[model samples]
Target chain A: MSRTKLDLWVGFFVVIGMGALLFLALKVGNLGGSNFTDTYVVMARFDNIGGLKVRAPVKSAGVVVGRVTNIGFDTSGYRAEVTFALDTRYQFPRDTIATILTSGLLGEQYLGLDPGGEAEMLKGGEVVQITQSAVVLEKLIGQFMFDKAAEAPAN
Target chain B: MNGLLNVVRLLGAMVTEAIWRTGFGARFFILLLRHSGQSLTRVHLTIRELYFSGVLSLLIIVVSGLFVGMVLAMQGYETLQRYGSGDALGVLVALSLTRELGPVVAGLLFASRAGLAVTAEIGLMKTTEQLDAMDMMAVNPIARVVAPRFWGGVISMPLLAALFSAMGVFGGWLIGVVLIGVDEGAFWSQMQAAVDFRFDIMNGVVKSVVFGAAVSLIAVFEGYDCTPTAEGLSRAITRTVVTSALAILALDFVLTSLMFRGQS
Candidate 1:
């Protein structure tokens, strides 16, 4: 009887421990990083999204304050439009410029917002008119190769 | 022409005998099922066996699972960090534990510990004429001895697999967050978002059930056919462990291939 009781207790503890661990993992990993609520939406148009995926961080003055929620193409504009969820607390002026910036030399792409001094704040669903597209690495590489070839011939 | 005729005759005889044995085995299975109604009365006996086998084996399983999880997480973190994608650790641990390590490791451990004991016990009964005595008393030995054990193992293996998976994931979390200073919240949430209960838990349980059936059948079959001697019993036990472990691994590979053939 004692052995049976002990067995049951052990089984109970194992189940409880597992359940707790699963709960903690879900709560921490998913909810902590990105707080989508209390955030407004803004749209930016680009020729290419590049390596920018959904949930890519959006930064303002080097601080992450939002994330990219959706990326689609505008048939009329013939441009890729990225929808961003921005914190409502940070009011973006109408003249703010949104640029796709790389975090490092070989890092993920993020949307960086430059707030311009303006009295009117951009509201939800408003498009940020001043948008800088992602830097095309292929074009940069082609230019570098061309410059190298020209310099080598001259030398 | 004469040599070819002899070979053809031998092949025909072998096929005939094989078919006859298969039919006999099928009939034996049906008879065992008919007698399986007695299993309801033997539930207590099965539970007792489970307590001794599964519950008693918890410490070893937990310790091993914890270490395996920790090692996996540490290695996974290092590799992911190299690619600057350390955030994907949760997915890595969850997927590995659920799909691969959980059932295979638990099955191997169970085969080593419980499989040997079961084989030896049944082998001893066969050698001691205890099985013959049961038959004389109008008791079907397979139904009474083998079926209860088979059912018990079938039930216990899944529970053990679940326990192993849970412990392993916790171990990974401990290594990732407490020891390695990963963002505790991020690691956990990523694991949750990545692992679905259907894909992880269900997959593990299905593998465990198949492993349980294979282990129990192989162990019981080996024991039942053992030579009536002490040395034979020892050999039977050794064979049981080896065969069950191998069967578990082979079945795991087959199941994994079938399950994930088109998915990835």
Candidate 2:
């Protein structure tokens, strides 16, 4: 092949190779847990979403069993409505509480479901009445700064 | 006080003259609109340029992305391991690559490699009267010369950015799984759990597209407007690189602000 032809082939393969690698990365990076036979939706209400994006994981007893599928605001309640899909097999009682929790000091927020031992199991579309909203770090920092400023002596 | 006042007056007069004679602000806006139209027209030429800029640069980008990913994963793993949270390596790599490293590094690389070449080529064309020759033939030089490259760069940059992010993630996965002994399944699941398409990848891709347009337009503008002299060509090339690089950074800041504007 001519030099220009060779250059063209090389360029073509480079793009192809890069594209293949990208495909692989996306595939491998997006591997979710094994598919479950039964799943149900759980709803929670929060005062503030607090940087909680959709698809954030929902965990129960530190095990990820679901994910936040959608988030919206309820006009009547004046609160953010977060809906999460959970595996049906992992049954929670009607009295179970859901709280938004962060993994670490600087980590993504996830829904944490605390299962309560009760005879009745929570059904799909049932709202988790006890909900703890997200604790925003910036808000905490701002409050700290405000408190310090208020405590300072007047000049 | 009098001296300062005179200095201020002189500065105001210079600004007024510069704005009027050079038509600085209006010229730039008109140039932007015209170039945008030109860019839209030269689709085929832009594709060819993309073949060069996006495809040809993949090797270096992949190699560099791989090592950067590996290094990031190793460091993150070591740090997280102390807290027994080594499983979070995938999340770390994915978030970092998508948000920051992917676009910025790929943009810098593209600017350094193809950006300078593009400026120099156009500068040479101006210095050698090639652009003038096109003009003599009644060809619109801006449409012919500058538009294709500007559009091409715009098209190519996002592809390269995506390539960079992908390779970097792969590199991170390799280190996390193969080297660090993290389970491949867990590593991937962690990534999936952490990253979302819109927040992570799309953000970088958008930034890349904007950076591409900025770099190419600035470089081509400096080159095409170069004075017909060897010294002028050199100066133009230098200015093109410096100005394009600065524009890339400045635009990135502005774009970031606009993109993340109501979100905390």
Evaluate residue B93 in candidate 1 and report its C-alpha lDDT on the 0 to 100 scale: 84
lDDT of 1 by residue, B82-193 (tens): 9877887877887788788988998898887777777887899999999999989998898788667666666667777767777787888889888988887778666765
Q: How close is candidate 1 to the true structure, as a TM-score?
A: 0.63
Cα lDDT tens digits, model 2, A84-143, are: 888877888988888888878778788888888788988899898888888988999999
lDDT of each: 0.77, 0.76
| Per-model DockQ against the true two-chain complex | 0.12, 0.16
Best by lDDT: 1
The pairs that clash in candidate 2 are none
* Model 1 CA deviation exceeding 4 Å by range: A1-155, B1-32
Clashing pairs in model 1?
A: A25-B188, A25-B189, A28-B185, A29-B185, A29-B186, A29-B189, A29-B190, A30-B189
Question: Among these predicted structures, which one has the highest DockQ?
Answer: 2
Global lDDT of model 2: 0.76
Docking class of 2: incorrect
